[model samples]
Target: MTSIAPPRLPEPAPAGAAPPTSAPVLRMRGVTRVHGGGATQVVALRGLDLVVYPGELVAVMGPSGSGKSTLLTLAGGLDVATSGEVFVDGTALGRLSTKALAALRRRSLGYVFQDLNLVPALTAAENVALPRELDGVATRKAYREAVAALTEVGVAELADRFPDQMSGGQQQRVAIARALVGPRRLVLADEPTGALDSATSGEVMRVLRARCDAGAAGLLVTHEARHAGWADRVVFLRDGMVVDSTGEPSTPESLLDGDGGSTAGGAER
Candidate 1:
């Protein structure tokens, strides 16, 4: 009788891991976002400072309209800050040309949205390989990478399923697989588990934490207190500023306080 081979194991991390943090993966200094100029102008971010280090999982929390989305977009280079500067790996965004910036973003950044922004018509593998396809990678190679990414996120079985065929948790996992499929250095997720049920949200957060532990930096923008427990740090934003931050570490209990911070905005700058 032929013996069946055992399943291959995931790659083990190096014995001596890199410092959990180093030069920040992304930095924003005195960042400010404005809605309209002059009379109609409204400041979204009021000269805020943010830094995310390698292997760090940081969560951003704020009331709606507090500029949480704007801050995430600015950090991901999806939206430009109206004033101050943002740096991804020390490359100040203001210094790069549009084409250069686009290239920089593709090389180092990955983003997941509340919508997941996946194509309904495409299969999960195809959807995950979109970035690789855009970069002109060979189809076979791109799909191969996509499959590996899916496996890492425990969604390889769903590779052929369309978005509509997957559950909300499965869809979010696929989105995460897509984000990290490439050689991503920074991962930005905007309320990734917002739509998931309690049990599923816990699973998704574990996946995210595992990714960050494996060397990728993650910035999660979320309102759910339970989800915050997945991060190494939780930063509270109010009226467009990081009013307070805590390195509470990840645990079910840390997430118990659904109301994360003081309502009175203080020391926002």
Candidate 2:
């Protein structure tokens, strides 16, 4: 099988130039995930290999049951792969103890779930600050970071409101803010814009993109081609394997041109 190469992002660096960071923020090697046993068994992934270097935003796209969500879960350390290894910031997730893995997730990784997953009892600011607080950040500092993140997503005014008090799009922005709050090195987002309008979605993407530009890596799982266009490159999956990937820089206009690159269809989250 041929290996799929990463896309060429806009403004390519001069020839022979080294990237800012020599280490990749995330690396997946021969990863496979299986659920159940015998007749009921399901293979969610198969020998998947991926690398997201610092300052890169990679988008994952595929049809229903393509294992997009499973990929995110495994990358975020929320779920373990049946085989292979997952590395974040040069540390292998499979090699870490449960407590160490949890600590790594708190200090280095951030994840935005499709379901929002906000605590109903906590206000938006509190929801965003909870991770930082749990990571031992001072309360005042965590609250400050939370408010700043909310402002980045254009939801600063909603900081005092509970999850139930905000609209779906607003809540989605809040979830995004929570993912972006601390000094995380990698962000794994699953359909982060599913609940937002086009305008709001663009804003959220801009925030995510900006974070990547600032040296953090991001893996975005989305069904919309326009959304994927914001990424540095797009990886297409099919039947638990990477079928193709685009190497050219993608733009919304180009993706809509019908021949710009791979355009994913069928919703899977």
Instruction: Give all candidate RMSDs, comma-separated.
Output: 10.8, 9.6
Candidate lDDT values, in order: 0.80, 0.83
Candidate 1 lDDT score at position 24: 67
Clashing pairs counted in every model: 0, 0
Predicted candidate 2 versus true structure: per-residue lDDT over 23-117, tens digit per residue: 66787877899999999999999877777777778899999898888889999999999999999998999999999999999989988877998
TM-scores, each model vs. reference: 0.82, 0.84
Q: After the best TM-score superposition of candidate 2, give how far the Cα of residue 11 lies from its true spot, in angstroms.
A: 10
lDDT: worst 10-residue window of model 1: 257-266
As for model 1, its CA RMSD to the true structure in angstroms is: 10.8
| Model 2 TM-score (2 dp) | 0.84
Assess candidate 2 and give its lDDT.
0.83
Per-residue lDDT of candidate 1, residues 146-207 (tens digit): 99889988889999999999987899889988988878889999988777788777777887
Clashing pairs in 1: none
Residue 42 lDDT (model 1): 83
